[model samples]
Every structure is written in C-alpha cells, then in structure tokens.
Target: SAVISQKPSRDICQRGTSLTIQCQVDSQVTMMFWYRQQPGQSLTLIATANQGSEATYESGFVIDKFPISRPNLTFSTLTVSNMSPEDSSIYLCSVLFSGGGFFGPGTRLTVL
Candidate 1:
C-alpha cells in the first residue's frame, strides 16, 4: 500500500474563511477521495477526485463549498470554502493503492 500524507496537520480558522488541504500519495493511484469526520460522528465522504475530470461530490456537499482539484495521479487538494462553526471537523484523504486502502493523516479544522 502507498503512504498518504496531508499538509497543515491541523488548523484553526475563523468563520467565513477557507482552507485548502493538500494530499500526497507516495505512489500513483487510480482512486482518491476526501472525507470528513465531525465531532462524535462517523466519517462522511465529501468527494471523489477524478483525474482529468471534475470531482464527484457526495450528497449534502456542494462543489461551491468543498472544491477539489486533482492535477495528476498522485496529488490532489480539497478546499473547505466559506467555512462556519458547523464545518469544523477532521478532514482526511484516502486512496486505493496496490489493492489496499490507505488514509492520510487527517487535518483537523476548527472554525470559530
């Protein structure tokens, strides 16, 4: 399996601001996705980063609020836009590599 890493391991942002998280995979992978786990809640899929195409967002998530960019096979970014206190959560990137699934160290965001 490939090792995944995320930048800005954690952050504290003010409401109405935005933050972008970078996800890097040690090796090329075909599938990449973003997820968020709110306090005391399970992980929720935000979107699927598709190479050469727009990301596919899951229900309750809109591209305008959670934009994603996949420039290549091994790198992608997810931006939380116009954040609010309710948006504060732990964000994660996941990839399927070598028949195994791996998750990047999450980025914890706190919106004031």
Candidate 2:
C-alpha cells in the first residue's frame, strides 16, 4: 500500500497567479493521476503522470494550463498555470497500487 500526502493543503491566490501542488507517495506506484473536484461536483480526471515521459491529459485539460511532472515513482507535481477563479477547486493526487487506489489529502485552491 502506498501512503499519499500533499503539500500546501490549502491556498488563496489572486487571479492570474499560479500555484503548484506537490504530491508524495510512500512507495513506488506505476499509475498515478491528478483530479479536480469542483464545488458540488464529482471528480474530474485532469491527467495521468507518466514517469520520464509527457503526461497524458484528459479531453478538457491541456499541458499548458495544467502541467504535470512525474520525476520519479514516489513524487509528482501539478501546477495550475495562469489560474483564474474557474480554476479554484480541490486538486487531488491519486495512486493505484497493489492494495488499492489511495488519494492525497488534496490541495484546495481559491482564486480571488
């Protein structure tokens, strides 16, 4: 089982600014993902982080808006670039291992 944690649990940023959320896993995992949960909405798959390669972004997401980096199996980072109020949401890091899917505490961003 892999234990996951995220940095900057919550943040308030001005519109047009960006914030990077860090996700760390205790063990190496092959499948890792980034999700966004908007207010009163279900989770949306942002992208899948591929180690040593470019991340696979979902239909509505793009590399320029939400860049992801999976430097290694244990760590990844997602940056919300050129953020706006619409970008304000709960960003969660998830990993699938032998045990099951584990999610990080999540980084809540509020764009003002």
Candidate 3:
C-alpha cells in the first residue's frame, strides 16, 4: 500500500489565477492518477503520470491547462492553469493499491 499526501486541503481563489498542487507518496508506485470531482458529480480521471515519461492526460484536458510533472516514482505535481469559477471542484491524487485504489484528502478549489 502507498500513502499519498496533497497540499492545500482547501482554498478560495479569484478567477484568472492558477494554483499548483503537490502530491507525495510514501512508497514507489508505477502509475499515479489525477482526478476531479465537482459537486454532485462523479469522479473523473484527469491524467495518468508515469515515471520517466510524460503524463497522459484524459480527454478535454490539455497540457496547457493542466500541466503535470512526475520526476520520479514517488511524487508528482499538477498545476491548474487559468482558473475560473467553473473550475471549482475537488482535485485529488490517486494511486492503485493492492489491486484497489487510494486517494488523497483532496484539494477543494473554489475559484471566485
């Protein structure tokens, strides 16, 4: 099992600003995934970060808007670019563990 930590439990920011969230893992992992969950909405995969290679982003997400960095096997970062009120959601870092999944506490973002 791997333990994950995310920065900024919650934050409120103005529109047109950006926030970079950091994710740390206790142990090395093969694949790290990012997700977004809006209020009353299901969780959606944002991207998959593989060590030693570029991150694979899901549809509707672009490198310019959601840049990802995975420098090693146990850490990653995601930057939310050009924030807007509609971007308000719970951003999470997830990892597969023991054939299941685990998530961070989540960074609740509210762009005003």
Candidate 4:
C-alpha cells in the first residue's frame, strides 16, 4: 500500500484567489494521481503526474486551471488558478494500489 499526505486540511479563501496544495508519498512511484471530491460527487481524476514528464490532466481540466508539477518521484503539487465558488471542493492525492487506488485525507476548500 502507498501512504500519501496533503497540506491544509481545510481553508476559506476569497474568490479569485489561488491555492497550491502539496502531496507527498512515503515511497517513489511511477504515477501520482490527483483527484477532486465535490460534496456529493464521486472522485474525479484531475491529472496524472509522472516523474520527469509533464502532467496529463483529465477531461474538464486544463493545465492553466490546475497546473501540476512533479519535481521528484515522491512529491507533487496542484494549484487551483483563480479559484471561484465552484472550485470549492475536496482536493485529494492518490496512488495506485494492488486492487485500485488509495487517497489522502484531502484538502477542503471553500471559496467565499
């Protein structure tokens, strides 16, 4: 199993502000995944960041909106650009598991 950690358990930010969340892993991994859980919605994949390469974002997400960086094999970051009320969601860090994937506690953001 992979252990993951994220910063800022929760936050209240003004609209139009940006927040960068960090993710760290206990061990190096080939692919690190970012996800979003918006209240009643299911987990949606934001992007896949592999070491030494650019991050591949999923549909409905773009690099400008959710810029990602994987400086190393065990660390990655996601920034929500010009956040709005709709951007208020639980951001999560995930890694592939034997059966599926595991996620971190998550960062709860509220845009006021």
Candidate 5:
C-alpha cells in the first residue's frame, strides 16, 4: 500500500481562475489516476497519468481543461484550468498498488 498526501486540501477561487493540486505517494507506482467528485456524486475518473507519458483523460474531460503531469512514480499533479462555478468539486489522486487502490485525502475546490 502507498501513503498518499495532497496539498491545499481546500480552496476558494474566482471564476476563470485555475488551481493546481499536488499528489505525493510514499512509494513508487506504475500508474497514477486523477478523479473528480461533484457534490453528492460518486468519484469520476478524470485522467490516467503514467510516468514519462502523456495523461489519458476520460470522456467529457480534455487536456486543455484538466492537465496532468506525472514526473515520477511517486509524484503527480492535476490542474483545473479556467474554472467555473460548475467546476467546484473535490479532486483526488489515486494509485493502484498490490491489487488495491489508494487515494489521497482530496483537494476540495469551490469556484465562485
């Protein structure tokens, strides 16, 4: 299992602004994923980031809006760009390890 941590647990930003969320894992992982959870909704896979490669985003999400970077096995970042009020949600990073998935505490964002 890997211990995960996220920075700026929560933030309030104005519309059209952007925010970058950081994820740190305790151990090396082959693949890392980013997810978004809207209010009262389940977690939705945003993108899959692998070291040394471009991130693969899920349907309804694009690289221009949600960019991801996996610099190494243990570190990754997801940025929400040109955020709007509808973008307010909790963003999380996760990794599959030893047949199980571990996720960070989550970065809560509220776009005004």
Candidate 6:
C-alpha cells in the first residue's frame, strides 16, 4: 500500500494568478496521476506524470496550462497557471497501489 500527501490542502487565489501544488508518496510507485474535480462533478484526469519523461495530459488539458513535473518516483508537482474562476476546483494526486489506487487529501482552490 501507499500513502499520498499534498500541500496547500486548500487555498483562495485571484484570477490571472497561479498556484503550484505538491504531491508526495510514502513509497515509490510506477504510476502517478493528477485529477481535477469541479463543483458537484466527477473526477477528470489531468495528466499522467512518469518518473523520467514528459507528462501525458488528457485531451482537454494542455501542458502550458497545467505543467507537471515528476523528478523522481515519489514526488511530483502541478502548477495551475493564469487562474480564473472557472479553474476553481479540487485537485488531486493519485498513485497506483497494490492493484488499487490511492489519492491525496486534495487541494481545494477558490479563485476570485
């Protein structure tokens, strides 16, 4: 099993600003993923961050908007740039663990 931790568990940001969230795992895992959940909505995968390669973003997401970095096996970060009210959501970091998936507590962002 694995445990995930995220920084800035919740924050309020201004429009046009940016916020960087950090994710750390207790143990090395083969797959780490980022997700976003809008108000009253389901989780949407943002990207898959590999240990030594570029992050693979989902169809509606672009690297420039949501840049990710996975420097090693148990650490990663996601930066949300040029924030807006629409960008306000709960961002989560997940890791594959023992054939199941475990997620961080999540970062709740409220853009003004």
For residues 8-98, write the lDDT of model 6, one tens digit per residue: 9999999999999999999987679999999999999999999999999999999999999999999999999999999999999999865
Please give each candidate's TM-score.
0.96, 0.96, 0.96, 0.96, 0.97, 0.97
Runs of candidate 2 exceeding 4 Å displacement: none
How much is the lDDT of residue 103 in candidate 4?
Answer: 86
Report the Cα lDDT for candidate 3. 0.93
Pull out the clashing pairs in model 4: none
lDDT of 1: 0.93
Q: Candidate 6, which segments miss by more than 4 Å at Cα?
A: none
Q: How many backbone clashes does candidate 4 have?
A: 0
True lDDT of residue 112, candidate 3: 95
Error of 1 at 31 (Å): 1.7
lDDT of each residue in 6-43, candidate 2, tens digit only? 99999999999889999999988776899999988999
Predicted candidate 3 versus true structure: per-residue lDDT over 1-112, tens digit per residue: 6679999888999999999988999999989999999988999999999999989989998889999999989899999999999999999999998778999989999999
Clashing residue pairs in candidate 6, if any?
none
lDDT of each: 0.93, 0.93, 0.93, 0.92, 0.95, 0.95
- What is candidate 4's lDDT per residue for 1-71, written digit by digit as tens? 88889998889999999999999999888899999999899989999999999999899999999999999
Off by over 4 Å in 3: none
lDDT of 5: 0.95
